[model samples]
Target: MLVRTAYRLETGLREAASRVALRIGWTAAVLPYPGYGTQGRARVLGRVLLAPTATDPAARRGVPGWQRLLTLERPGVDVVVELGGSRRTVRSDEGGIVDATLDVRMPEGRATATLTVGERYDTATVHVAPDDARLGVVCDIDDTAWVTNLHDPLRAVWRTLARSSGGRRAVPGMAGLLQALRGRYPDAPVVYLSNGPWNLAGPVARFLEHSGFPAGPLLMTDWGITPRAWFRDGQAHKRSSLERLVEDFPQVSWVLIGDDGEHDPDLYGEFAARHPDRVAAIALRQVVPRPRERAVADDPPPDSDHDGSTAARAPSGTLVVRAPDGTGLLRGLRDALGVEPDRAGDDDVGW
Candidate 1:
């Protein structure tokens, strides 16, 4: 009852704020995120926000992550999405997120969906995987792709809240590694599945592009309160997202990439066990604990013998590799996937 009461209060406050913002001449705008799907269906991802009519162009260049969280959500707004000669109207959720899957026959490769909220318009890119595409890549963002210092809570908060997209550092060689994956499986789709909030979608996309990572859809979750709980379940979100991917692309096998800093190992292990045939391999980035974290660690120290040198097999018979960074993982993946080393040194760049 207390939780329900809190949720109601939060909803009421947001509605009041939305009304005031609209009365003050704030206009509804659509902020689109890249989506992915099969040739028969496409998922459209975006958010509806109420923003000022006149915004400073200069200030928009490198807005800090914190400012993005302060957006006034225009929930339940109608957004018209046009793709593949079909037009459909979808309503935003309570969080102003427009996640609609439309049945439209688009050719394999890149496609665009036009989203219109009121008079404002934006385009979302949707990657349509071919029916024959068997391999896919799923990556975690935080410590796996970039340095978030998740071992230390305070530093992680500082990095997430204070840093701009350009200011945040990318995991060395990760972009080149992803590029190698793309080159090896040209038709395969690489999806970034992160636990980060949807508010940072723009910044995260910018970071991935600027850092030279392969372009793909970002599956992010919302922060704060949900219908049943005060805080969203990050682990549950990852689990459900992975399951949904299996349902959407039943023929595609995935190389799951994440870090051991948190629960990636356990989560990926569970998924691979459930869908053994769907998971091609599991790559875990071994994050060495910080001094403070080590002091309070409950588990024993990792064995030195198994540090990125050996390959293990999960219970599902899927190959598992552990590396400290992307370069090692790329090499391990090459051996596991039976791909020869790149003579052109493409994977050696962006370190």
Candidate 2:
């Protein structure tokens, strides 16, 4: 009863604020996110927000990450999405997120979709993976791809607030590792699945591109109060996103990459156990010493058998590799995938 009351109060406050913003001449704008799709269907992802009039220069310069979090959302707004020669009107959710799956056919490779809200418009890049593609990649963002220091909450918050996306450092060798995977499987799609809020999508996407990581789509969750809960469940978000990927791309076997600072090992283990055939391999970057507290039964203990140089098959028959950085994981991944090292360019490859 208390939860329901709090949700109602929150909804009421948001509605009141929306009305005031509209009365003061705030206009609706569209923020598009890169989405992934198969050959036959495409998922359009975006957000609708209430922003200052067209005269504001910040609209053109792009808002910073912290400012983005403070912006007002215009929920239930109508956004027209045009892709593959088809036009559809989709409604944003209560959180102003437009997540619509349309049955539009497009050839394999990168495609563009236009999203329009009133006079404001943005193009969302959609990656269409070939149906015959055998391999796909799902990577975590926080510690696996970039150095966010998630284990240290205070430092993580400070860095996120102080640093621009370009200023943030990418995990050494990770970009090269992802690029190598792309080189091997040219048609494979790379999906970044993170527990971070959607407000940081722009920054995260920028970081990935500027750091030379192969781009695909970002699947991030919304933060703050929900109708049913007060705070978002990060672990549940990751788990559900993983399951949805299995449903979205049934034929593609995924190479899951994440760090062991949190619940990644346990979560990936459970996923591999449930869908053994869907997973090709699991690569875990040892961001920090394995936590002393065992949060779950499936969490793998500290690596004592090898010095982050070998790939071992897990109990579920999936190959698992652990490394401190991408270079070590690259070696283990090559071994697991049975690919020869590109010795000619190995020395120059910096992630």
Write candidate 2's Cα lDDT for 1-351 as tens digits. 777788899879878988898899988888889998895889989998887776431233344456657767788889999998988999998888998788888999889999898988888999999988889999999998999899999888876766668678999889988998998889989999998888888888888998999999999998877667888889999999999989889899999998889888889878988998998899888888653232222335434334454456666888877778888788777756768756566444422
Clash pairs for candidate 1: none
State TM-scores per candidate.
Answer: 0.90, 0.90
lDDT of 1 by residue, 1-351 (tens): 777888888889888988898899988888888998794888989988888777521136577778878877888899999999888999998888999899988898889999998877888899999978999999999998889979889999998889888899998767777888888899889999999999888788888999988889999998887668888999999999999999889899999998879888888988988998998888777776431221111134432323253356776777777677887778767766767766576446322
lDDT (Cα atoms) of all candidates against the true structure? 0.82, 0.82
Please state every model's RMSD to the true fold in angstroms.
4.1, 3.0
- Candidate 2 regions exceeding 4 Å error are 1-6, 55-64, 291-307, 343-351
